[model samples]
Target: MTRLVVIGNGMVGARFVEDVLSADTAGRYDVTVIGSEGCEPYNRVLLSEVVAGKHDFSALTLPTPDSPRLTVLRGTHAVRLDREDRHVETADAARVRYDRLVLATGSDARVPGLTGLRNREGLTSGVHALRTIDDAREIVAATLNARRAVVLGAGVLGMEAACGLARRGVAVTVVHPAAALMERQLDEDASRVVESAMTGLGIDQRVGRGAVEALVAHGRLTGLLLDDGEVVPAELLVLATGTVPSTALAADAGLAVDRGVVVGDDLSSPTDHRVAALGDCAQPPEGGSGLVAQGWEQSRRLAARLCSPALSATFASGSAKAVPDRDPTSNVSDVVRLKAHGLDVVTMGVCGSQRTDDPAQRTLHLSDPDLGRHVEVVVSGGLLVGATCVGAGPVAAELVTTYTRRTPVPSDPAHLLISALTPQPRGATGSVADLPDDATVCRCNGVSKAAIVSCVHDGAATVDQVAAGTRATTGCGGCVDDVCALLAAVSTPAPGEPTDSPTTSRPREDDVTKGKHMIHSAETAGS
Candidate 1:
């Protein structure tokens, strides 16, 4: 059996291992995984939910793969890569040999270098960064007594964290260096609506401000001193500045490293064909979106290539064939949605802020600051190329679907923004059951309605079972309601039959329609 070693057992890394095990039915490889966290892999994307008291720590646990040929080294840190020896050295002086190596060393939460941020003990009390499960736990625990909190960033993660803390009845203030929140995804107009919505949720914002120092009192955080010489009083501080890709291991091994480990579309390092990298630690030609869905796609593609018979034959001869380059445009819809309660913000492709003056690009904008709603769509080549929607759930949902599916835009792009408000035909409710078999229900995993129904037919009755079988509702968790709706439609018994199954009871049509509205409007929009 070929030896395979994978580093960084995070969400993407773990999914890659699962994909390999699923495809390698011949038992052709012995897989070993290294995780620095000491615990089983969990969904790091939902850490904000944990902070909101929406789920317990145990709820974040991910399913572990059980196989005799697989070995997992939890709490172990890989210290060195011996390229010449074809092995990895751990911090505990252990070495693991491998014929193939995968680096999924994701990323680290970047903590800004502000005065009084750190002391002799490192990161004075009450200052925390939300990256790991442990960090979420610490933040949640602190929220019990934290009446006032300050979040130092206005990116997706920062806004989510701020809203989460506010949900816990904490007065949260978000300080951002950027003039607008989520500037990468939202333009100034859409951001204004989002800011208004967040304000309605009782979260304060200070845009275009920088944190000059963290004020500590008696070894604990008391407030943040801004560059404007203003001190915002707070008992706790959460840093959501950004993330720095963990490429030290790859760089130290003499592999190419830019912002991340440089790899080709095939995800193979130029210097070493035997070594591969994916997830946040690797920079591919198409660039990294820093989204878990993108990493999951990379993992799926790499695993497919590695398990191909052609590659297997080449590996046996101590040589490997290059995997065909993936189409750059395939799955290029980088949808970013803020998964915070009471916030409906979603953006995709080229955002409103990034729209250019090209004559061929058709752009439409609608803003209602008083109503806290903004919608913008950019059309090019008769296809929806970019969109930004804030404080408008149904509109956001429709735009996301159009953008991801590359649906042709109406001659007048205004219809794209107002179509959600237009009435549907009689008995033509928006239902998952009405969707075609090929309709994508889970954009994160690309699971189709047919795939989900197949799982239902295979005796997967609950949402969790369907997720385990089809990998739906596992990314961004935006499709759980849709999956549940489908499950009901698939499992409901015919009119005269006895309802014995737990899911045999059918949901009321009105309830289903209401659910559709809530899901499309509130549940991360699409992804």
Candidate 2:
């Protein structure tokens, strides 16, 4: 059996192991996973929810595969990579051998070089960054006594952190260098709407200025000094500045490293085919979006390639055969939705002010700052190429469906914005029952409506059962409502029928296969 060693037991790393075990049913490989965290692999995407007290640590845990040939080392750090010797050296001076290696080291929070930010030990007391469960725990504990808090940075994570602190009954102030929040995803108009919505939640914003220094006294954070020499009083400080890809291991091994570990579409290192990288740690040709869905997609494709029959034969015979090529069209999803409470913001494709000037694209927008609603769409070739919606959940949902499915829009383009006000037609966005069989309900896993229906036919009565069957509602937890709705719709029997009756009709094999293929194609079209 081939020995497979994977570094970094993050969400993507653990997912790759699960996919490999599911496909390699014949026990063709002995797998070992190295994780720096002491706990099981958990969903990092929902960390903001954890800060808001919406879920406990257990809820963030991911499922692990049961296999006799698998070994996991928790709280272990990989110190060195010996590409020539085909082994990895852990911090304890132990060596783990491998025939193939996958690097999922993920990323580290980037703390700027502000004065008084760090002490002799590390970050000064009461200053924390929300990148791990420990960080969230610290932030939560601090919130219990913190009367005021300041968040540095106005990106998605920053905004989420601010809202979470406010929800805990703490006065929150956000300081960002950019003039508008989420400038990369939203234009000025949409930003104003989002700002207004946030203000309604009692959160204060100081945009176009950055935090210059940390005001610490007695080894505890007291406030943040802005660039304009203004101090925002606070007892706790949360830094959501950004993240840097954890590429030191790859770079130390003398591999090609750019902004991240440079890899091809296959996610294999150019210098060493035996080594591969994915998640936030690797930079592919299409670039990394720092989204969990993109990492999950990469994990899926890499797992497929490593478990293919062709590669297994090559490994057995010691031949130089190249791995089979993947479908070139498979692209990662670019959808960005904020997971904060009382905030409805979603953006996808080409957005912001820069793209509106494209002569080839048709743009339409409706702004209502008084009501805190803004909707914008960029259409080209009769397709929804870009969209930005704030404070409008229903319209945002419809636009997301259209954008992801590449569904043709009405000729006028105004209908895309106006249709949400009227009753939606059949197979439209309002009701789960009206969605077409092929419409995707879970964007994170790319699971379609028909797939959920098929799972119901196979006796999946609950959301957990359906998740176990189709892997829906597992990522981001944004699709739980849709999955529950579909389950209720399919599990409900005809009038006067028994309540516990099983679904009588099952989807045809051909139909299921075709639906899967179509979903795959839609996912990979713009790669």
Measured by TM-score, the strongest candidate is 1
The residue pairs in collision within model 2 are 329-524, 330-524, 331-524
How would you encode candidate 2's per-residue C-alpha lDDT over 296-363 as one tens digit per residue?
77776777677776654543443322212221221236677776767888888888744657788998
**Per-residue alpha-carbon lDDT of candidate 1 for residues 267-310, written as tens digits (9 for 90 to 100):** 89998999999898999988987888778777867786788766
lDDT measured at residue 63 in model 1 versus the true structure, 0 to 100: 83
Give model 2's TM-score versus the native structure: 0.90
What would you estimate as the lDDT of candidate 2? 0.81
> Residue 173: error of model 2 in Å?
0.4
Once all C-alphas are superposed, what RMSD does model 1 give against the true structure? 4.3
